[model samples]
Target: MTFTGRPIRIAGASGSASDRRHAIAEFARHYPTDPVDVIIADFMSEFNMATFAGRRMDQAGNAMPAYDLSFLEALEPALGDIAKHGIKVAVNAGVCDTKGLFDVVSRMVQAKGLDLKVAYVTGDEVLPAIQNALSGGQSDFRNIYTGEKLADWDFEPIYAQCYLGGLGIAAALAEGADIVLCGRVSDASPVIGAAYWYHGWQRSDLDKLANAFVAGHLIECSNYVCGGNYTGFKSLEHGGDGWANIGYPIAEISAEGDVVITKQAHSTGGAVTVDTCTSQLLYEIQGPWYYNSDVTAIIDGIHFEQRGVNRVAVRGVRSGPPPPTTKVGITARGGFQAEAWWFLTGLDIEDKARMLEAQIRRLLAPSAEQFTSLKFDLLGSNLPDAKTQNRATVPLRIVAQARDEEALGPRKFVKPISDNIMQGYPGATFHLDMRQGFPRAVFEYYVTLLPQSSVQHQVHLPWKPTARTQVIDISPPPQTKTYPSRQPSQAATHTDQAVDLAKDFGPTIRGPLGWIVHGRSGDKGADANCGLWVRHRDEYLWLRGLLSIDTAHKLLGDDALQQPQLAIERFELPGLQAVHFLFRNLLDRGVGVTTTVDFLGKNVAEYLRSRHVDLPVRFLNRGKL
Candidate 1:
């Protein structure tokens, strides 16, 4: 039925597999006052997908699914509340085994004696097709970022999952399913599907679908749009929200496609302001265009309005038809990786690090040819003169990756390094845990695109007596346009000046750039996107002019310097007073196998902000962030 009442409120309870378990219970606790129509949890990611692939191999005949248990843990406690309130649930936690999860959830419902109609969407796993391609030696599957062909890949791909859209989800909900489980549906697909079902939206309603797409994208990360990863975190602390128990976000979408983002009314911590919304808006995005399986959202023109306490109205999102292709992730066993950290304390930190590295390399030189990669990172610098022991200490981390586990075993990799501790530099002590020196399997992810028609999207309605499953095909749009990797953004209304910001804003002070700027960063495969913005419109021109590709490279410091080819694409979003940069191949082979300490690149923006830059004294006079 078409929605004619109040907006459909969809609450996001979990962002990742490891998100706090109490969030769903929090929503249930506040259900009476802050009721929602549905709750959606997102659990799958490239990193976790790799984990599932590894588990599939390790637990070959295990009866239990290699699904993310965290989602089940978060949802089970709230099931009674959900059933009583008739609140629908959707989650993409069925990483590699949607059917297995569906069976588990069905049994749980039976045990609870609840009448919830559990449904699951599947067909995302397409490993057989990939296997066939491999058998035939087809090289059509090419990496989206590096253009590396599948045939040229060093490792043998054992698992492949294509991203599915929301049509399958909408079908299940429309068929009266109370709970929907999906495997590899786009992160925002649940929200989009719920909206589509609620409003009876058809594929012809491109604009409405686009609006739902944006709303889903916003709240899919749970509290991120509510200040979880906000750069203005201090504001949350001082503004009486205090951030300890940050509230999860809810998207209320109307039939007209307008969305109002809010949180549970009596929820503690975090506020829904324009800045917080903007932070999530700029996160993990590549350019002005946000591509999903169902629709391509044009977010460059999107704007946020603070509409009272803990409320933000999102507007101006446009959309085009879905692209012809959808993203496919292939996972293979990369190798084994092991790491060791040494504390370099007190005087001559650099000299000590050099000596330690020399010793380790000299010891490992016998079998160094067996190592696929080896690197040393000096994480921090010791303080000058007098300070506490912690202050005068920095970690010298050595990470080694190799195809052979024995190559990184204690006998070869660890014993040699650990044996040198006594003979190493003064005050040099290694971490006590010798197990870390043992190699762990690493999974590599290869991302590429497949035709939308190639995916077999299916919805399974288990409650149905007969003809329970329906095949839903999402056809590619008839007309599609290529979006530029980088788009020229609108210029600041206040200035056309090309001069340095110091001339316009006032005298400059050398300090952290974060004082006047706020940022949020995330990863897309191996690439990292750092989006930074300012609080005031007056600061937009200065920020846009100051943060260039060259500036980003310099600010990135050693990470950029170490890369063989440092590629960064900068784009502007003047409406939000933000500059976004996409660093290609920055995270190496994605988060799953990346040796970088940053992992998902969540702190790339923080790293950039920490770098010293000349900030206008006038801006700093307001306050340091």
Candidate 2:
């Protein structure tokens, strides 16, 4: 299965029929003499789904109708051109169900007797399965809502499937598929699978496969790796044409599976750098375990060295053992909740807001007679301790939660708040109308391992011009079921331990002036405001002193200074602090501060101002002293 010649190439067009046609025409015009093996067009986005569904509902009274056969009519001509060129065509941007599309294309192929083998990857449809598992399974998972779990509510998912990996592409290439259609496969899987087919690599060669996978991940998003998302990217001299003619990605892979991600040499304004490439590598990948259907890529290391202006040498990656279980996505019924806001005016706004909220709660008490569970909150006003003197217009928001649809239906619960607004409190204005709120639906996910024996690989040959239509159901390998040993009780104990550990740590030290500390869930990486803090120090001593000997050594290399004073003059403290404070404030407001600080000395200007409030005379000599 070794590919020789010039190498297998793929081009991508924008997701629409028209955009794809234009992009293909553009590609053809630019490479009048060169030929490619495959062309893929992607047109899937969240917004695309919403629009497609909306249109379908208007025309056919069902949103799913948009995915019908008529939708692909515009693409047939372009696909015909690809067949004529002896090239394969793929569509990476489309719906979740490949079977529906296959049925239509299969019928068309039978009628026309076209020499084309089509294959598609579909697994995002498994999200519902994952959701179900998260809700029903007895894994003692954290409640995304109240952050609590109960054994009585344990359940299991109806189905679970991994987002098909490069293996789909591999499967397509193996079966000699002329056109591969896929939904939500990792951006890099197509190229990686194609490379594997061309190189004839074995599954045991994990290291080489990982290198290829990493390369694909780096450039799969196209523009993000080609200066569009580069933080320091400078615009090219060629006006608007620089970004306008940006090309899709191409990877020159080797027999060992090492890849050089690049675009056509003659393509318009594009440059690949370490920053651009690395940013894409870190995009959606959660951690060391990069999951796919076929392989689990354990990214050991990533290094980018300049090969040329547009070429980067990606090397030094390692592989890890694949997961024992496959993850399932399931969607199920959770509960219901709603929020309503009101404007409160007059003196002692906080006090009046609290009193108004109490009145509404009394009115809703009658509805609770019908509902088993009901909860409410009054936002905007600080109630229970309403002694604050600073008075202003307050926006009061009331929210309620309930267990069942019948118990929490909007008609039964919402009108009570509106009915009581002006009866008990003066100057209380209700701004929003009470509308029925959608019931809260929880999506659960479960993880279970299937033995390696259950998965197998096979390839099909390309269709001949006069070949008869064939539908082969490739049997998957025998799946080995290995239930995780940890029970629901043990899992709950572990969660309790984690919560206790956090509480035991007490308050962390306040970040230096102009900086703050924060935490991210879901295994995301750490972020800090230290970069901004270093910029604000007037004496430059705080910034220089901030770095440990090891960090300074790594950052400065051989020129690492022995004394912090050496770099003092080189430091643009005021300018740096200004930028630092700007970002620090933004992050604080954007997310939230995790820890509180007694004093923020990182901003020298702010520190001096604070000192002026306490000791006016001493503030003038503070910097000099």
Candidate 3:
């Protein structure tokens, strides 16, 4: 088929529902004409959804059920503008209740006296399916990390949400939905759904859908593709302006499966370049194959070129069939935790921490069993003849966890620390956050896949059947059929030939990797991936060798490298001159349960960037210092 169709401009307004008000207002200011066919707002993430589910459970009998007002608060002010411009909005801002949010929107818009078609895509809630599986021995539900059964847990489940695709959203838009509210679809699905509807593409049109899928990924995180979170962010125009006026991203997707990612025209402070787009594309991706509920996008075939000022054309796109299963996010109350911190100054920081832990151990001797976990981390250095106060003082952070509130509560956990006030180390003091010392609920997420056949999807056309509520049937796409994994130029096999250092480059200097390389990394549940790229093609060879598995293991430091569960896998994108590394179980029980300092794992790239490495002297002489 010849590629002939209108290009759809999809703009992402909000990264999360909490920032919708600002996102909407900023978009309204920047986009005076409101130049977009569909506005996508991503309001929910794995953390936020779990948080909402926990809140709803807590507010079971409250006078008014708990619903996040941030989304509506943001949308209320922009309703007039949206209705005036006739721009359709797709958002996953509904949290756990799309119906309730839509109901609120229905009333708000009606009061404003605007003619709009408000619809909601529902049926992502999979609690009943989980219950059914649990009732039948729970063998069906397995943890995505460890292949253990969910039935093994003794506690009850808080929430279970399955990831849905863009079909239902397309159906809603087909019926002329002015506002499409959704609970928990893929973050990129809103863009995907909008593109699908705009192009009137078929389910079997893999190439078109693949392009849309990649395009959605580009604009999914508003400012990331527009230089906000990019590693080489300083290269963008006004890169120092900060995020105060950071612009949202816009994707110009053509019918021929070509995408040019850009920012709002005349928007303040950002640039869409090949580097920025590449950075965003590598963010949060597991492998070359970027999988979604609707389709498994083959990102390995990606090709990019700067088409114009502030525009990057991404082409050579392809796709694989959608995965046979959809991932279901399962969350439950893990336990309660209480923590206290003490500062040690002048000297003997580690010594002071050890003494405090010993004192606490003696104090809790009677009820030691009451605590399931007690950890003390001595933060900062106790350098001899310290040059600054910051280096001389260290803080001791002690945390304790238990199965319930009573045992690991503030009264019980804090009493031991407080009792040793006089007997503790000299010049030791504590700055306490009253809430942190108190027992607080901790959530654990169990991510796993479920067959698409079990999902119940419906599109609620609120204006259908006499401007009344109407639910239309929407089915899942056919099972994904496997295809040959795309391997680009950089996939050349490793050569065993000895490196001729003199032939490659004359000499070398040691410096931070960030000087010659850029990187982006993120987490998916317990797993993490980071992509490192070099600007010059000649630098790619050196980087590939520098970041090999053995070198990476050494670079991760002794603690992370020696962990038994740590497994590393590398995929090379030769076309882009980048190496993507997958680190397993790096974030403990994911961000929600991890006790690590880098909880979300957003800083992995920065951590690697900080590592000092050798660079070619000649290359350094040619590039800016």
In each prediction, how many residue pairs overlap at the backbone (N, C-alpha, C within less than 3 A)? 0, 36, 1
- lDDT tens per residue, model 2, 1-625: 6777554565544433233234544444445455655555554432233333343334445445434333365356455555567565556544544555666776776667677777765544543443444466624533321234423334433332333456656767666787777654555566667767767776666676677677666655555566554333344336434765565555566776666756655656656655456545544443345655445565424556668877776765667534454432222222455556677654666677668767876777766665433433333443444455324445666655454566556655666666775575667677666563433322223223332223332222335353342232333322222333321111111222223322332333322222221101111111112222221133233333333323322333322242232221011112222111111121110111111121121222232222211112222233211
lDDT of 3 by residue, 363-396 (tens): 8766568777777787656777889876777778
- Candidate 1 deviant stretches above 4 angstroms: 61-64, 131-139, 468-502
- Give model 2's TM-score versus the native structure: 0.55
Highest-scoring model, lDDT: 1
Q: How far is 519's C-alpha from truth in model 2 (Å)? A: 14
| Model 2: CA > 4 A from native | 5-7, 10-36, 39-81, 84-96, 105-115, 121-156, 182-187, 227-248, 263-271, 306-310, 335-403, 406-408, 412-442, 455-625
The per-residue C-alpha lDDT of model 2 at residue 177 equals 84
TM-score of each: 0.95, 0.55, 0.91
Root mean square deviation (Cα) for candidate 1 = 2.3
Q: What is the TM-score of candidate 3?
A: 0.91
Error of 1 at 25 (Å): 2.5
Greater-TM-score candidate between 2 and 3: 3
Consecutive 10-residue window with the lowest summed lDDT within model 3: 484-493
